[model samples]
Target chain A: MSKTKNFAVVLSAVVLVCCGALILGQKVNAAGEGKITGTVKLDGTAPHMKGIDMGKDPFCSKAHATDPGKMETYVVGSGGGLENVVLYITEGLTGPAASQTATTEPVFDQKNCMYTPHVLALDVDQKFKVTTSDQTTHNIHPLPNPMTGNIPWNQSQPPGAAPVEKSWKAPEVIPVQCNIHPWMHGWFVVVKGPYATSDSNGAYTINNVPPGSYTVTAWHEAAGTQTQKVTVAAGGSGSANFTFKAK
Target chain B: MQRNNLRKWSSVFGAAAVVAFAMPSSAQQTKYDFETRMNIESHVGNITGHAKDAKPDYRRYCVGCHGELGDGNGENFPWVDPKPRNFQLGVFKCRSTPTGTLPTDQDLFDSIGRGFDRSNMPQWSTFTKQERTDLVAWVKHFSPRWVGEKPGTPITIPPEPEVTPERIKAGREVFARVQCWKCHGVLGQGDGPSAATLTDDLGRPIAPFNFAEGARPKCGDTDKDIYRIFMTGLDGTPMPSFADNIKPDEAWDLVFYLRTLMSQHSKEKAMAKQLGLKPVDPNAPAGQQ
Candidate 1:
């Protein structure tokens, strides 16, 4: 009996050592992490973003009375920099960098009857929070293509409501809208690997990308997608800039 | 020897070719792969339902509206207002579970028997309990979600409390706080300020339920069902779950207030009449009413 037990103990040690080595091997491959950084700009004159009429909801109208909410379909910053474009590695990402799901939760906020950030880029299976900061009621409904394996859901966030935490199972560009406020619209750009959304100045940095050649794809809501190829060296950075023609 | 080896290889290749041709490509396969899901079973108490057992019943009844692939694209698709549910997506409006999760076997069982009110679906209570249980498994087999995911844990509903004038009034306060009137209207008239703009998951124009219309809710209209509706929410619609905001005790109070709004006579309505409970003041500052 003790001999059998000893055999079992030895077997487990072997299995543990093998599993640890496999995990450490993957970590070693994931070392020398680099990043991809770039700016996305509009090539032509930006379209006119119509001002929203929040007259339906008194609270929404009052909150934005002074500033006045405008459409976010095309938020072109100074120097024709396009905002809200998501950049992600569509190819060449492998091992831990490719399979790792982001643990940090991103917040998609509804404030003053408009979705904050306008476009939220997320890693597939990464948890995110939906929060409401307005006095009025808003339903956060993300409609994803059922074929993509990401199911659609509608949840209401009233004033002072607790945050709803959720995550997507697959990569899809889901259109989120509030049924109560038809003018409210946003996008949840879910991607498989490392991703970043273009900031106010159209700048983005996809961190923790182990050094490798990659095909980075930039996706815009209305302007469509563009791909660029780049290579990164150990402990260094790669850059890919994109310019989308405005409609 | 070379000739024998060639003959053996040819036979192997021939069998492989036959197998390949027998399997239908995904694009050409319009029917659901029922063979893989025939083993799916549903349990409602002691009743154990086999998906295989419901095929004949589904063909005779449900297939007319639910479709051959259970995609809700049956021949009756063009005639319906709010279209029949596409079981393939697995997202349902009636669920005891929270939003974004599969409904429990019992929830689906109840939905089949209760049917949807004011919609094309008629109550299928005529079917035996065993038949309905089998049908629940059949409904689930259409979605890959059943194979990959489990039904969400059903939300907890506290025991019913005695309805009083104060409880009814407190329910009104709960209604005001959540601003249910934004789409449901102050008097539950389905003509709230935001009602005109409301749409379902499909982007089709959908009207909020008018409690005064004398029509039963799409989900069941029982007291427990009403509590579950607001708590779990009608997914794929404008109605949201108040489970996060409304306490379990207060949920019962709101349920009673909603009872008063309904055209149907109820004990709560009789009590509200005696108490002179008025419609919530939508214009009242947040909690001042």
Candidate 2:
């Protein structure tokens, strides 16, 4: 395995193998597949939510620093900015059922009144295209439980229309609240695999996965769940990380 | 000179842990080194009135607030708006099994070894069931990372039943006569020897987790998220909850020596070699996302 460890294992298998990353002798339903890339890194540290009166808001005194509501760095070290966090891939991950030139799901957005992505992970089935640019109205809750409870859908985005898509069968973690902005929250992890989405710098990637044995999870609507365990060694490539603790 | 008297008693214990994390919390109120379990029959686990039997100083009197090494931090954990409790992300708000499931090791040993009287964490039966199975194997040793540069420690080693071969060489001599090699080093590998001066809560350093970098931490091989981490102790960090004093087959042989101290590292082998693909094993499950 030399030639620089086979190009350091082919540049960590093409910049972190995605598309359901699998590979041991190749057979999770192998057809020349295996992938998962990484990068959901927001640098680190930012918690800020504890009885947030933040002296009665301005986006809670610019994303809050203290009023018993601490958690700085809306800028320093860089924390929370990318609104719709949906790094998807459902069970054995390869891709499909996201038609629209290969965009099966995950594009949910809302820009400002909070929820630009307090974290949203996806995988099972797909379909979730929400949109709102803001003029108020808000409320598009989607709190899935009973593993996707008949896809517990909700809507209200109002403002400028044209962005509503929906779909999800099971997996869990969807609590997209905004009863007209009761602190406008968000979270939607679902996961099965073939994931990515971590910007404003947290970084994420998941592609073409076919190799197998996964347990790769990393979630954070507020900050929780950060699993790991990957093998994908047929054509070979693997690396996983998730740190969240800075609320 | 035990290394200059343990480096002057770890620089006076790192200036008393940075003056107990710079005081406040109403003047530094926290301490539960281990021991809490109450009488043993004040609960029954969600049948309404009989479920509180796991307490063991829940990893120093209940993990900071109620997180997985009981989940709650990230500075102060967005101040707990129904957040906190990563019981290795099994998820629970007070379950019967419907809000996304995952709560029964008796509904997490009766809501953290029986306490919840309006919550922020209380009632840790006086500690035992082996300090709530050593604070449920130190709240599944807060997710083991580190691979080669060495990491994955505090300890999550459960799973050793069957015995023989002189009790698996006396359980590797009860794992170095239970110093677990001073914070799991030698081979359980989180770098032990007190892991080159630990650190975390922002001091940095912090290293441990190295079962050959294969980390898959939900930190629960099950048994009700390892008995709700030996009956609740992850409210914040140092991880302590052995639910009265270990048992349930010694919390499953300390979760198989903390899953052999997770040889550490595997965000799906670093996102399958960072997008280039093919290292995949993630325990052999197939692909589909």
TM-score (all chains, Cα) for each model:
0.88, 0.23
Q: Candidates' interface RMSDs, in order?
A: 12.6, 27.5
Q: Which CAPRI quality tier does the interface of model 1 achieve?
A: acceptable
Worst 10 residues of 1 chain B by lDDT: B23-32
lDDT of prediction 2: 0.43
Which pairs of residues collide in candidate 1? none
> Which candidate number would show the highest lDDT if scored against the true structure?
1
Residue range with the least summed lDDT across 10 consecutive positions in model 1 chain A: A14-23
How well is each residue in A89-148 modelled by candidate 2, as lDDT tens digits? 433433331211223666767755555555656555666687767543343555454222
Q: Write the per-residue lDDT of candidate 2 for residues B119-165, one digit (tens) a residue.
A: 35555666544444444334433322100011112233445354223
Model 1 misplaced stretches (Cα beyond 4 Å): A1-31, B1-34
The local distance difference test score of each candidate is: 0.87, 0.43
